[model samples]
Target: MPQANGHANGHANGHVNGHVDGNAAPLPADLIDPRQVKLHDALHRLRKLEAAKDIDIPQLIVVGNQNSGKSSVLEALVGFEFPVDNGACTRFPTHYSLRRGEASTTAFIKPGPGRNEVEKACLEELSRSIRNPTSFHDLMRAVNAGLGKKVGMERTGDTGKGFCDDVLMIERRGPDLPQLSLVDLPGLFTASSGHQTDEDQETVQEMAETYVRNKGSMVMVIASAQEDIHCSSGIGLIQKLVRKDASLNERTIYVITKPDMAQSFASLKSVVDQFRFPRPAHFLRNQDSGRDRPRSLASRDAEEEKFFGSGEWVGVPQAQKGIAALRTALKEMLWGHTKNQLRRLIPAVQDMTEEAQRGYKRLEEAGRPDRRKFLVDVAQDFDRLIGNAVIGNYVNREFFSSFDDTSLEVRYKRLRSTARALNKRFATAVQEHGKTVVIGRPRPSGRPHGSAPPPAFLAAEIDRLYSYPEPESKCWADYETWVAGMVDDWRTGEPRGQASSMAYWALFEYQSRGWKRMAENHLKAVWMVIDRFIDLALAEVCPDDGVAEALRRRVMDTHVDKLRLAASTTLESLLSCHGRGNSGFYDSLDDPHTSRSRAQALISKIAELPSLDGGGSPRNAPAL
Candidate 1:
């Protein structure tokens, strides 16, 4: 059993700590611990899964304003001088996954699935170009060229600007490295410059937010202590995100760069002590400060040691002082987050497995060669659906029972309810209008007659005949005039009998016209219900494009059209008989000889009409 390395313990005491003395040599090959190897292997597995499945792995995101020493902090931690330049060096997010292994660096592009064949080919070509770059500088140049060429940003044409949301993943493994994953986002900018427009600024902000806003990510907001912290745009953005989700405050860490250049130590200490930001703040002094020159690894290590050993910083806690400390903290935080994320990931994997199984089962069922059985099953299903619709038994309680449930089933129920309500409204309109026809009297005078006048049959007939003025109906008016002339001719031949028959015919025609209009409205309402139900059923039964088209042509379209035509014909015949041929019409009248008895009988008949249930279906519905 070998002891784990300092990197595995996340204590920042191995190569980083050993280098502080400026004389500690690299760890020997025999000293490479098993525990450290296991951790690295586990992380590597996770990275592979994340890449292959496009899963989100837990990460620490380092974000700061341009020229705020973000690159310096990263270089200090990784001990690698990443390519840096003036005027927006980073146009894409760079992810560094550090681990302890053989001393080597490798880089690759991770494009999203939305990329086209051309973009994929371009990226592959770019990857090969920098496959074994002699230096980081060569790697950076290749990356810029690839991005600019693919996005058409190398030219000033109308295609695109230089900015993109693509990512570059670099894996650096060395005997001295810590087990950590870090994302370096594009630096925040206050204004547009050169080809960068206001839109470019927005793009950068969106990219930064996309990383830090991930619940699985731990955000590190970096700012130079020499600059007013208030001006740190990155800090303001982090604060805004934290405000929306206060739980983020627990995971966010603050890094103050260029601590050696601060104007007043007391002010800096006060800011740290007050903890106004409600997150731990660490102060760091990079190797090269206030100079344009680059220093060697040994020189950088000496600088860090000298600063931490000085009286100014020696009193500060080890956890809040150097790049090594930052690395340790990030490793520990990520390890914990990864454990929790893995626990959550288990259930998700199971769910995905079950869904896949279901899909496979469907495929197997579809592949069955028994075509006749499949057709028979489909026909039976359709027949059951039609029966349910007609009888109003298809209402799904899960959907219709709750107003909050807004599924398709609920919508279909509401549509059917509307059609039924319209039918009831049609019935009510017929009943109400018929009452006026039966009463058959002139507009009532404010003063009532002392006694009811004997049924003025002749006067009532006259009033009812002209009551419905059909200005738009030239043919109807002509027909009514011809009927009235026939009545006059009959009146001349047999005065008493013809008058009685004329009054009855006038009332009959008036009610028939009103009932026909109402019945037509009801028929239209039924047709709407049938049409909508068919559409909804088709969508549910045949959601796939190929199947839906075939089903519509072979079954739904033809079946629904035939049903609609049959329903229309049945309704027309029913309405004609009910309005013009029913014997009940005579019994419901107010003839002088039997007015009182007829009124009593009409009330009893209405009482016997079947009631409409909550499902909108009529109980004991009369046969049409």
Candidate 2:
């Protein structure tokens, strides 16, 4: 059996050279014990190979939902009692690699994805202090300790982390251990409870998904015999995954744990038959007596042999009975998977060679050609890059490869994505401050803003609009005082009843004119983002400063100015137009960019006016 090595995006333990030939000797086609030191050396070497992620490495990943007898099966397989019975459960992934040698157990921790250098170093240091684990219980404690002790982090209440994706790797060289290794993942959870949240459940689910999705990973899905098939989330996951890739059916194995605890053999068969278990499921009852005392592997095998020989399991083949047999079955499965990996070795090397040769040709090119032709190429490249950015295409691997978020090079390269984010923020700003007036009753005490952003977009503008302090002529005071003067201008000699009726329309028009001003501000803001994006795009497209500047001034600047002017002209026409041709609907907005909440708030306050819903010459305003 080979030891499984850890590899993250850009980190690895070591590198593998050409073909299947490297520091590791060629593995024989015949079945080998999975716990051998040589197999692990080969796997660890393969994991560090250049472009190794493109190749699927053989592994047995154990997965199940929380409290689904997942921990029990792992304990039974290793014959080392886990501390799960004492409130400690598998919170993070733990990968165990076993081999035969002078009895020694050493362990380490692999940082989870996205941990910074400082945190990774802290985890690595945690491993250095832990040279030996006297038992599996102590090994589990060390793992939890490493996971909980994040660098520069402090907390209270619980001593351990809620759930983490960080991996704990263990290597055991002992005279008594079996010849095998398996990856035990954090169990999937059904719902949020206790310290775990819905987010935590999702995290664990995704982690299990990552393992089972791997083509070379032989999944040991532990399904509880006592629970309904539908209730077991792991069964559901396997079902969906197998549907997507039918070949996953070949690698997946479902094992029913706690066969003795089921209501009856018939009831247990009902749970087992619900799912097409990929391969025939092996049913076994893990002994509960281990809880009071540690159970050795040899005793477990003897007890299982007697238990199966006298019961309904008597007819079951030796290949599908007990944890000891399952371990052998898994090792044989690995042997076949390894041979499959070797069959693709030569072709993989050929592809790598061709890709490298092409890369070399690109690197060797140098010197310049015709300046005009160069400029033309730059312009075409610029157009293509912009087109892709507009359409959200990232096919060009040269510049659009790395997504280092802090780099402006990466940020501006994604033109459409950047625009979408800005557009969302722009809409948010309009929703908050575009009204220029908030005419609702004062908010209730202790109530906070709900989902809506604060009026920070145009704070000064809103303040100036409401700055009216005159006795009988404030905009905030009600439409009456402001409309009183305007009412006389529109209908000087008309009856007071009719004059008051015209006041609502007058107030509506007065407030509507400000829409044009806000529209202009938003327009400028949009063009500003696009304009900055163009500059960044040009720099990337044409490395020559002179060529880039010439294009910016001659082509980009002129087209931008023309486009901006045309947009401004169109906006003017839309605002001023009022005729039969206008259906008053635009796809961009449900109600012409007017924030509906603000509009309703305004209507509620003004509904009390004598000219609106009041008894004195009550009249309706223009259609909103």
TM-score of each: 0.51, 0.51
> Compared with the true structure, what per-residue lDDT tens digits does model 2 show for residues 1-624?
211111012211111111111222121211246444476566656655655647666767988766566765765565544445334457888886655556666777878786643355457668776656655555565566656654322234644457777777777654444545578887777777656778778888888988888886778888766666577788788888877888787787778776766777777776666665657888666655323123443455566678878767777777777876666666677777667756775477568769768755654563245655777788788888888878989777676665544355565566666656555544544434333334434323331234222134323432332222212223455755555667777774567657553454555444444556556655554554467668878888888665577788788878976787798899888777622223232233322223556677677666656763346533554334
* Candidate 2 positional error at 29, Å: 17
lDDT of each: 0.60, 0.60
Q: Candidate 2, overall lDDT? A: 0.60
Candidate 1 wrong stretches, greater than 4 Å: 1-40, 50-54, 86-88, 102-104, 112-117, 155-161, 273-275, 289-294, 353-624
Which lDDT value does model 2 have at 410?
63
What digit string (tens of lDDT, one per residue) describes model 1 on residues 426-523? 54344334333333333333312222221222123212221232222234556577556666664534455345454455546654566555565445
> Alpha carbon lDDT of residue 98, candidate 2?
55
- Top of the candidates by lDDT: 2
Report RMSD (Å) for each prediction in the order shown.
25.1, 18.8
Count residue pairs with overlapping backbones in model 1.
Answer: 0
